[model samples]
Target: MEEVFIAHGGCPHWGKMPTRDASYLREQYPHFGGFLAQRKAVDPDGILLYGHLREMLGL
Candidate 1:
């Protein structure tokens, strides 16, 4: 489960079930902010973001 993964210092896969939120992911991924910034720059209209994606990326 998600708890087990976290307990062992693990991070969820982006394509799998989204058990962790943006805050958790930000901590796990060192370049989380850069990734978001690039995503925003390329898709400012959010054409590639919606529903769970917005929540996952913290947009």
Candidate 2:
């Protein structure tokens, strides 16, 4: 897989093709952070083992 870095509120051209913001990138950090944290818990041997950790931390 290849990753491309583009600045927010900016655009890049590819052979006369234009890529524009489609409201995919959210302005809130907590939303995306929560997503990753959820995925992390589903990980093997993750913090979900701890009962309190899952309830309080949502890890």
Candidate 3:
């Protein structure tokens, strides 16, 4: 239940299923999955998350 209120990508708009799109982000970086906490714990450098954890992290 606590996970429901937790912020995934520093905001709630990212949703429970974000995508690896090439679209332009006005403020945050497009591929900035680095900001995600879960992604950081597994792969702080973001090398592994791109292929393995993208779906899990909703990014």
* Best candidate, lDDT: 1
lDDT of 2 by residue, 1-59 (tens): 01243545343342333333223323423375666566586875664445543433334
The total of clashing pairs for model 2 equals: 0
TM-score of each: 0.79, 0.26, 0.23
lDDT per residue (tens digit) for residues 1-59 in model 3: 32453335443344344333323232346455545655578776767655424554446
Q: Count the backbone clashes (under 3 Å) in each candidate.
A: 0, 0, 0
Candidate 1 C-alpha lDDT tens digits along 5-25: 789987886777676788988
Ranking 1 against 2 by lDDT, winner: 1
lDDT of each: 0.83, 0.42, 0.47
| lDDT: worst 10-residue window of model 2 | 14-23
Query: Could you tell me how far off, in angstroms, the CA of residue 15 lies in candidate 3 after the best superposition?
Result: 24
